[model samples]
Target: MTEPLHSGEVDRAEYDVERGKIREFARATFTTDPVHTDRNAAQAAGFTEVPATLTHTVVAGHQREQRKFVEMLGLALERVVVGSVKWTYLRPLSAGDHVVGTRRIVDDVQREGKRGGSMRVVTLETEYVDADGDPVVRLEEVLIERGEQR
Candidate 1:
């Protein structure tokens, strides 16, 4: 890598949750929770509509944003591996809730390895805020690049 990426907003996106996606996620994850699939059940649980589980937010963010900072840093996706994904959720997001998110470069480091090779560890943090501008969740992830860099 030319230089270690600095902390800053690297990408952004907006997402609108749909009930079907939550239902599919609930089923795929074997949640078996009525609140995830049943709109009425979710509303009864205090959400205006079916809410996405904590896991769904990360999935939805990736799908909807369709981006990453490694790519922006001119790194290859095939060489990147997820080291960790830490989440901090402030409030549950409901279906029909429009959320805006920013993908930020929290840190990046390059280290020398054996056999005269080097690797880069890129840290990213994404924060999602609802249309109400309330913070929803913060996803802190570390992506490590392997193999040789061009």
Candidate 2:
């Protein structure tokens, strides 16, 4: 078992939204909301362009943050388990908006388990901002058993 892990900051990554990508995500998620797939419908809904759902933003930016966090830990990918995820949307994300995401380690704890033996819980908070520098979303991802407990 390795030593207890410490928290660290991870660099951000920017993603440029593409219409085709939005449409594909909408289709795969079985989202029938016109605002997510049709530009006209979105504008009619008071948005400048097709607006992506909050869940869609996970793939757009948060996923990249998760990958970078894991890589920074120098731990094997297979050893990490995403225990939970929660997010808050500050503003709508449109199909053509560019977003940058930054992540910070919020907490880390070690506990002795009854069956899983020793375990560690790591929490990370990520913020996403649009091209205009406005906050778009905030996400919290909890990675459990990411490394050795001892």
Candidate 3:
């Protein structure tokens, strides 16, 4: 049997920020703040450049980056389901900032079920930081894996 993914090692991925992404998101999400849509306004507001709104963190923190763990555990991608995505913003994620996400499996547990047979509950966390090492946001995601019978 293949062992589950344990916590310790970290996976890192660099994300590039695009101006249009933030602008389009802001327009769609009804963010009235020009700081998100205009570079000049963001600079005047003391940010290095135009910054994305709160919800935009989702793009930078997607679970696709956690595939390393899924592969390590020899788990089939089809069986894994995303349980939740909780984001804690430490600071603003700006457009000009070079960002990187450091991902890790924070929690793992197994339980027996009457109907489903067995289940594994895993919690993964990805912390985003700027090139200067400033904390941007922390993304906590949960993934549930079930037994073959179910």
Q: Summarize candidate 1's per-residue lDDT along 1-150 as a digit string, tens digits.
A: 457557677887777877888888888899987999998888787878888877876655555434444556766778888899998989887788888878888788887767667878888888999988889989898887876856
Q: 87-124 in candidate 3: lDDT tens per residue?
A: 89898787766788888878777767667577787877
Badly placed stretches (over 4 Å) of model 1 are 1-4, 59-70, 113-117, 147-150
The lDDT per prediction is 0.79, 0.77, 0.77
- For model 3, what is the C-alpha lDDT against the true structure? 0.77
Provide the lDDT at 143 for model 3.
82
lDDT score for candidate 1 against the true structure: 0.79
99: Cα error in model 1, Å: 0.2
Mind giving the per-residue lDDT tens digits that candidate 2 earns over 1-150? 344467667667688777788888889889998888888999898999888866776674544655665677654677678899998888787888898888877777777666667667777887889888989889898887744544
Candidate 3 Cα outliers beyond 4 Å, as residue runs: 1-5, 27-34, 40-48, 58-69, 114-116
Against the true structure, whose lDDT is highest? 1
Preferred candidate (lDDT higher): 2 or 3: 3
Superposition error at 150 for model 2 (Å): 13
